[model samples]
Target: MTTRSCLLPPSIIRPGGRPLLSTGRAAARAALIALSGLLWVGALATPPPSSLRGADAACVNCHRRSGLGSIEGHIAIPPIAGPYLFVPRGERLAELGIPFVDTARINHDPYTDESLARAIRGGIGANGKTLNYLMPRYQIDDATMAELIGYLKGLRVSPSPGVSTSVLHFATIITPDADPVKRRGMLAVMNQYFVDKNNAVARTKAPTLYSSHTTMFRVERRWQLHVWELTGAPATWEAQLRKHLAAEPVFAVISGLGGSHWGPVQRFCEEQSLPCLFPNVEAPTGHDSDFYSVYFSRGVLLEAQLIARELADAAEPANRVVQVFRAGDVGVQAARDLQAARAHSGQQIVNRVLPAHATSKDLGAALRDVDAADALVLWLRPGDLSALEKVSPPTSRVWISGEMGGLEQAPLPASWRAAARMAYPVDLPGRRVVRVDYALSWFRIRKIPLLAQQVQADTYLACGLVSETLNHMVDAFVREYLIERVEMALDHRALTGYYPRLTLAPGQRFASKGGYIVRFSDPQGPRIAALGDWITP
Candidate 1:
């Protein structure tokens, strides 16, 4: 039941109504199929062409996981889902409840099972014309062709959950342990953004015709945001999110807030196939293998790598590394990450874990034995940093977590400021003014108080990005499609608040990849200077 390429010349089409596929010809055909980005039916045992990577994902890459197909430059990859393929000519897709997709071809004749098989076996279409060059011909067996057609027929055509004719519902998750001030700021931005989005749309719920596409009509759907606040321990957070989603079904989760433990929420999103976009978390937990949970950056985990890179490329080699952080905080993970990064460097790495409710005395005890030869790393909060005034830095080679300690505004006392270099994950303050000002202007107009500048700006950026992606999507409200569109749309963003640049591709979840290592310029205030250029560790 293995699939074979139907890219043979006319002389070699069939000797006796069967494909004459030799080893070299089969390999050559695989290359052509790979290049054409065609769907292969029942090729589970077939070895992919050596030069092409992700051969099995060819169809998904072109037609998309939603089967809604994408438009690349001038090329239109038409939707292949059952409704678009099998619907009789002149029947409005809206009448059949199929959401309008820009790439759908409504004028084409309907595809019968036999005609569809013919299209697959040759480069012909249901209308007796040749298909697009992007579509590769496949010589699939009758049984496998039937299975593939069945699979296409089962592809979801209706609008995703939380989508109505005139309103689209979205949710934002807030963990109980999240910072109250930051949560308030993020919510203010999200609420205001949603309000502005809906207000800009016409009051009437009339459906307007899509551009140049007569069969499909676009309805202006108002955006609605639901705030899902999770309570209790991290273990219970997932269940709470599930309950919230059940009560208020949403197409996607956007611009949420989390504290040290976003793992539960991240897992819940992945398991449910929900798009959790750019959540603000001190420490984001997940692997590149994950699909649904995307973040602006890796958070403190990225800072650890930045610090590690510094340590590796330092002019003076350190005899030992001393890391300090409070227990049960995101710094715990950051410390571990740095330790892992320095594993093969043959340096002595010591971790000083303070009590959850530690005091100045506890901080003093942690830095008790550090000396000039040692490289000290602090993964502490503002309170812990302020207390450092009492305990002078034990080493000149000191690295601090700008994220946990409050970026350029970290309250490292004057004595420690001169000695410590901060791992600033976001764009340098001086460089990002114009980009950040856009969000700040929106806040000022809406009269939303600027409590947490970075958090609010990031939330606004997330909302803008989602809105832009949706605009490109037109009326297709598929969750997978939303995520895919976000990945594609991120690179085109000119206003990436707090970040120098943001980009994402398939399997690349983190949008902003690198940061600058900075040192405080003055003893007090938020003034800072970059020690060097941005480093992507």
Candidate 2:
């Protein structure tokens, strides 16, 4: 055994062969050091390559391994790759133009990194136009921006296997300054009805030819009174609308008609002989015609009945019913519901109408008058609900209930937690089928504090219903509109989930009906409830 000197460099031993520090070896060593330095400099100067920085990587954390596909959920951000690449690059981008670019043509090329940067940062498109009002302007630094761009560029555009590229376009004409809540409500309802992603047909500050094209396409058009806020006089809105009509023929209009400006839009639709669907607006008794309105007046009455029924059901069967409502339309509706309940349920029903601006003390005094019934049904706006909740007794036994609109616009104040139950219509974030898997997954994964709350459970229920209903509606619509294609895409079992197989009929509107009974169980405690399909008893 020969003892090897550990201290000696390998170069001395290898000198007879390929020397460690030979001329070629020295050149290679120098090259390696220089390359390492260059790489370090590049890393520092250029910012880590966006792929390494990880914004898109973070996105994939939720969107999943295949960038183009997603797990089912209502708020599930759709895959950005695959066939729907048109969504981000074509549709959403075109709809939300590039700020300052103003190419005049729609979806002109060069939807580059800079254009996307403007959209994410300034909420402006490359075309110098503001984007869809809903897109939140995220605060992204240059490094993150580079990363996002790199990630987007890396995305493959090949359509996902088994996915189709065809998209159904449903247009809605909405006012430039539409009420956010109402607009959201409308979108929520349509989402439930059509089971389609909400897409804007066209947006305009003035009623322009662009709007006319949208209307002719029978897009859900939203007309509002605030157009006056833009032009001082309502006439400017009319003029713009006329210009749009001249360019594009319109079919019918869906009147969200409210305030003063409704008259013009309504008149335009009427002149065009196009049908208008107005929610809750009634037609003349015994007269049937093409134009229809679902008036708000009926909504008030239906809501009142809904509240009365819910209160009666929740209370002890023997408890008498008393309704506290404001004077005018709301008061009358409450009175009718009480009368109907008295006739049907045989429970004693009483009505108390307050002045237009009734105070807390007044409501408290009226509330005290009722002895036989501990349960009270309020038919008032959110402000009134807030006031009443404050004044009412805070005990679990003393239950107060009302309709969806009865609760204040904001979250229930701390003090009123245990004292009230309010009816709420299902909406996107609240109640929809798409949320079920997501909520369950979130609860299972992070154990988020908010998810631990009982209110979140109620929200989960609402979301379930929304998803179920939308799935049902879309399935039906597709069966009627594109039967062959839908049947080809899904199996019979999948179709059953969307539409009841027993009642498969073309062009039939499947009513996806549901409501929630949200009650505060304790003050500063937790809100709890049961929600399901709203079935009339």
Candidate 3:
């Protein structure tokens, strides 16, 4: 039967002479479900809206953005898409164009408009069994019921752009401010990954067997990658990204490279509803409400928290805490975060921002006020670290950002090496050598230089993550499903490269959880000593 038959409009009241629902009343019911979840009990026998937006989550919350549904602790929420609902009895789901999902019910009678309404309004299934507790019993008016049913049918009926029968296209972005070395390394890995994906199978296989829905065989789909290199200022990066997306029309963004500013790219991805998997950016844009963009970590923002925790655990608190960073760098935020964390700690906080591209004299000037009783924090690059040789010792207890100062290889003068305690976000050089060597071997084989080791490693990790998540997807290629699968699969990952452990949930986006606080073991060399254990803040 058609969807028209599934709907029970006001014109068709019960045989017991029940009054027909007014169109205005139905419209009001829909508006109420959207605004509030409560139902007026004094009205008709219609149950509450199928979704109690205030109490129980909406149908989409469980069924997923793709009406294909999702599995939660072995309780399967079956697909409510039109084809899955209206399939005729004795006919296979494959007989129609419906794609196969494990949750779709078999050996059940097809639902008409009337039966679908019964399933939505009452906790009853098409086969007359009581629905699971997960199913909400809604009391929606006839017009609103039809509208809701219609909305479900249209949820994911159309295929997303850039999806073809034999190919899936993706894009990677690079900002002008991105490190040139890291950009090259990232693109190299991405290109190689696509090449390996396309060459995995010799030929496309035919449908050797069939069950209920769609083809039951694999299709050799080639992966295409587009590198979108943005120029000009950070403010114009979003426009450039939009233009690239329009021209390329990619299915998703794989692994990208970014500089101090990733907010514009993050905003573009959220606004465009694009799945930007992961990018190598020290400071990432964050929003719990956004679903499209995901990150490996919170970048330097996470480091600030770790430093605060370390300070809290200190044996003796410093009289004053001073942070020195370049004006236009991402360190500005990290400094602010440090200041906020020390707001109630009774410590005097000082910020010394050196002008961008400042000379060695300026670096010394910023540290001149740092006294013996003060704890100094440096958020500078190698150039500034090398410049530190020009300044005399101001404090014995000092902190540095491992990310910005090149981890263990920061160009610190021998005089300052014993004083600087680094906030290392990833695994230690000793513990991660085996993992780092694996990527280094790949680079050597590919004849790629090792200019930016951490960036390249992170980019490689991102590409691998995307590849693994796609494998889990099998043939389910919906954009929303891609993101959902990533979130679920992240926890099971064993080889997380730099991070000791990576995790994410429905509301969590940053995957890597914590870092270590360490100091140089001696006056020279790359050896370091962990001041404390891994901290997640």
Candidate 4:
């Protein structure tokens, strides 16, 4: 629980504002008076005032937004939900059909309206025992206390939508502009994963007993996946998603694919309070305050930062940095992010945006004005990279988007490869082979075609993570709790696929926070060497 500081008198002064004598009987009387004053101060200070909303706000910090208490270190903050608090004595929680919560205080005396109020205001339990020291004693009026009690009673621990007795329904969203090959590969992995999951538990219909002593459990549920493919303008994607959700409600959206604009889908998830986990998006939307919509990385925006960091630390920073990208591509945002990162650096940032359907001639023209002293950044796709053969290397100080140009397999011309460094935002090929091969080996055994290796591996990883988190949650299927569990579980993941490590906390939406800056080891083939260690900018 959150603690606040209080101001107490620094010295024992007389009521007439004079310092008391330090010796003999006067000192004794003053000590007694100070002790009485301290008791009064504690009463007034402990439970500040009757601001009901403020007091209740503290409940969320301690008990969590779900009203399902969490364990901090060795301390078990028990659930304060109405069912857990008011369940009658001698009544088995499983008999009442209440799901097993790890933090539940079982077999305790039930709290009445009066006792519960006493517990809140006086830090005394219904059993006439003192509550945990961490539990603050709030002082509120009768009406306000009643309203708060009513609010806590209203908190239900009912199962969320798409959670049936024998099925846990989930969805995967795909935008119209997403790559067809990657989409096919992602769906292939997702389908095979679901089949393997159910096959492993085909004959196991036993209740999911989370405890050894109690008869508390829920029927094991088969996993179900729904593919929600959006077709139309980005503006209409949200409405389409809502319609699909209305037709086929899901507990969460997982491992979705997107293109330049994943904003509508991200916004829809946040608005619906739905968990959108680890979507494959280049330019992800939303700030730290966003509750739903977690991603593996920031994608190209992350690459931009890597490049900006390189420029900032350069022995002789470029006089002017030039960024070239096609119009309406996700690179536009990447370029803007780079510019913003270097806003206070005093160096010039020049943008050269080509036509959306730019030809080799137009691409050459976009690079023609670059000076030898200026740093060049190419935020182009493979096709545009191949077209760069028509133009000479305008600057020796050059950086390219490893993400947009397809990582190590980017089709950069030999001349540009010799001069350019790559903003490598994923684990290097050699470092991640073993972890990545785990997925590859599974695909080989399942005979699932490896069309898009990265996307498929990430999708497989997402499915495994969600499955693991659900297992940890036991029978609690609350959406908010799902997000909370993900935040807690990510740091413990060992096989994080392409990323070196994945981590998230309350406000962190991006799991992988850093990447490497690399350069081509040779003029030919897809061989690269890191210029330095991983950078988190």
- Angstrom error at residue 315, model 3: 3.8
For candidate 3, lDDT tens digit of each residue in 124-158? 88999988877777776687778666554444533
lDDT of 1: 0.81
Q: What is candidate 3's CA lDDT for residue 421?
A: 88
Which residue pairs collide in model 1, if any?
none
What's the number of clashes in each of the models?
Answer: 0, 41, 11, 0
Give the TM-score comparing model 3 with the true structure, all chains together. Answer: 0.86
Candidate number that wins on TM-score, 1 or 2 = 1
Q: Kindly report which residue stretches of model 4 are placed more than 4 angstroms away from their true locations once superposed.
A: 1-57, 207-215
Per-model root-mean-square deviation over C-alphas: 7.7, 26.8, 7.4, 11.5
lDDT of 1 by residue, 1-537 (tens): 333446533212221111223334443333333322333433432232322233543555578666688778899888887889998898987777777787788787899999988876676898899877666555556755665676566557667788887889999999988999999999999999988988887665554544544324555689999999988899998889889888999889998998889999988987777889999987899776566789999989999999999999989889899999999999999999999999999999999999999999999999999999999999999999999999888889999999999998888899988899999999998789999999999999999999998899999999999989988877778887898789889988999999999998767999899999999999898999998899999
The deviation in Å at residue 276 for candidate 2 is 3.3
Q: Return the TM-score for candidate 2, rounded to 2 decimals.
A: 0.37
- As a whole number from 0 to 100, the lDDT of residue 52 in candidate 3 is 38
Better of 2 and 4 by TM-score: 4
Put down candidate 2 lDDT per residue, 1-537, tens digits, no spaces: 111223323322221112123234333222222112121223222222222221222333333322332323333333433223223434433244211111123353345568767755666665678754333444556754554454444444332111122322222334443444554444433333333222232332333454332232222322111111223344565566656545443322332313213444444443432323332111111112112211112233444555666655663664666667666434554456556755777677777778866787777877776654445666655566566555645333333333323322324555655555665433322334344445445444544333122223322332333233324322111111122112212222222211112121112111122334566544543334544444333
- Residue-level lDDT of model 4, residues 1-537, one tens digit each, is 111212322222211122233333334232222222232233334543333333332665557656678877888888887789998989877678776778888667899999999998888898899887777676556754665575566556777788888888999999999989999999999999999889876877565645563324545679999999999999999999999999998989989999888999988987777899998898897667677789999999999999999999999989899999988889999999999999999999999999898899988888888888999999999999999888889989999999899999988889887789999999999999999999999999999999989999999999999988887777888787788789878988999999999998767999999999988887778999998899999
The per-model lDDT (C-alpha) reads 0.81, 0.38, 0.75, 0.81
Deviation (Å) of 348 in candidate 1: 2.0
Model 4 residue 463 distance off true place after TM-score fit, in angstroms: 0.3
